[model samples]
Target: MISSLRKDADIIIKKSIDAVLPDEAVKRALKGFKKGTGKVVLVAAGKAAWQMANAAVKEMPDISEGIVVTKYDHVKGNIPGITCCEAGHPVPDENSFSATRKALDLVRPLGEDDTVLFLLSGGGSALFESPLIPGEELQDITKQLLACGADIVEINTIRKRLSGVKGGRFAEVAAPAKVYSIVLSDILGDPLDMIASGPAVPDTSTCQQAQEIAARYNLKLSDEARNLLGKETPKELSNVTSVITGSVRELCTAASNAAKDLGYEPIILTDMLSCEAKDAGSFLASIAISNSRKGDKKLAFIAGGETVVHLKGTGKGGRNQELALSAAIGLNGLSNAAVFSVGSDGTDGPTDAAGGYADGETVSDLKEKGLNINLYLDNNDAYNALKAVDGLIITGPTGTNVNDVSVLLIS
Candidate 1:
């Protein structure tokens, strides 16, 4: 019974991810875009950068030259006329600084009539960084925010201030050059300015908000970094045309449809599940147990959103993996039930696995192997724990970024 349900989960995961790939969506967003009389150059950044740039050049083959800065290993194949550079993600590195300089240089020479085709996506805040402070300082600030369990919006709010390219500053740098931005949002509610720190869109986040986040999180910042936070970001940008495509909401709906196709009554719990990873997992398991009581009827419950992980221990795991590990503890002996979570981008945290899986049998299996889920959870080491039970879900890079999805299945 568990094996059959596992197959169902795999099918649902594949279909859901395939449905949200940026290829078709990028093409749709570009349908009405016409290249200006001036030269058309492309700058793509984020986890989805390479894929989005590939789609753009295909649709508008007249693109003269382009640059793509994405997570390391995310650049699969090269696009002609586009230089693809891999960079650090969730944290910016020297490659990020150099790639961003290349982009800034590309657009600085453009005339008023020139069009800068900007392709932005989720990890852009890190992958397309040009820090006003030292690169080491910027990396340190990012680590502080992540360690403090700051959400994406709050993290990006602080990040926008320090970055030379973010917070509508890239649009500012393009100056007279028209920026046609196509964004694939991974943040909840699609806050235009918060997604990828709004490189092209006018920032709605203010200095006060950024400062408030710093205070709330007790973030450790250098004097230079704190001063940047006080400086306001661009609130108005007249040279950019922005279009947002794809989000976690779309991801949830696709998962629901896939679950229905598998003969399970699918219920989309929420598309904005923001909370601790462990809590989300436990909640999903509770729902699975509740539904399992209604015998013999298969059901799938889906929740989609980005969750946070507070680093209590030096655990090597992402939120999705932590979420699944927590669910395993709750699922312990629940019969014919299972839970799984995956990132739409095909990589979760610093690990290779997209996320993880936890079924009723997981707890017992771990016990037999002298593994305690609680200890792993305490250390935030869901990756190794899940690995021991063959629960790690590795999909490599899926060429998309749309937050994450967690599913509860009762058969």
Candidate 2:
């Protein structure tokens, strides 16, 4: 039974990630693209930057020049006329700065008749950075926010004020040149201003809100960063036209269909799940337990959204892995139950694995190997624990980012 569940889990996971690959979505979004009379340059940034840019070049092969800034190893190969540069993610590094500089230089001299086909996606806040403060200081502030469990919107709110190219400032830089921005949202509710810190769109987050989030998180900040937080971001931009192509809702829908095809009754619990990673996992396990008692009706419960990890320990793991490991505690002895969570981007945190999975046998498997689940969870070591139990789900660089999806299966 567990073997069959794993097979079904694999199918659902593959289908979910494949459905949000950004290739089709990018091409669809570009159907209405109105290329300017002057030079048409491309600037793609985020985890999905390479994939989106590749699709655009194929769709409209006459782009004058291009620059793609994406997370390390996400670039598959060279695209004609496009310079693809890999960068750090969830935190910015020197490569991020260099790549962003190249992008900024590419569009600085454009005139009113030119068009910047800006392919924006999740992870762009880190990939597309141009700091108002020192780079080291900006990285430290980002680390502080992540450590404090700041949500994407909250993190982006603070990031917007500190970045030279974020918060509609990129649109400002490309002024006189039109920016046709196509975004792939990873945030719940598809908030245009918060996704990838809204490089081309006007920011609605204010100085007061940024300061308050800093206070709430007790974020340690340099004096420069602190001052920048109080500084205003661009509240209006006139040169950018934007459209959102895909999000977590699409990821969940794909999973639901795959599960139903496998003969399970699929229930979409929510597409806006936002909470602590462990709590989300536990909630899913509870649902699994309740439904396990309802006889032999196979069911798949799905939740889609990004969850935060509060960083209570020094060990490594992403929100999705942590969620699956936490669910193991409640699924210990349930014979026909399993829980799995995976990131649509095919990378979770700094690890190679996309996410983690657990079944009824997971607890016993750990105990037999003399590993305590509590100790692992306390240290936030889901990667190692899941690895030991063959529960890690690794699908390298899926070329898209729609957030995360967790599924509960009872068979």
* Whole-model alpha-carbon lDDT for candidate 2: 0.94
lDDT of 2 by residue, 1-411 (tens): 998999999999998888888999998999888988898999999999999999999998889999999999999999999999999998999999999999999999999999999999999999999998899989998999998999999999999999999999999999999999999999999998899999999889999999999999998887888889888888888898999999999999999999999999999999999999999999999998888878768999999999999998999889999999999999999989999999999999999999999999999999999999999999999999999999999999999999999999999
Cα lDDT of model 1 by residue, 191-297, tens digit: 98988989988888889999999999888888988899899888899998888999999999999999999888889999999999999999998887777777877
> Best by lDDT, which number?
2
Off by over 4 Å in 1: none
Query: What would the TM-score be for candidate 2 when compared with the true structure?
Result: 0.99
Can you give the lDDT of residue 332 in candidate 1?
82
Clashing pairs in 2: none
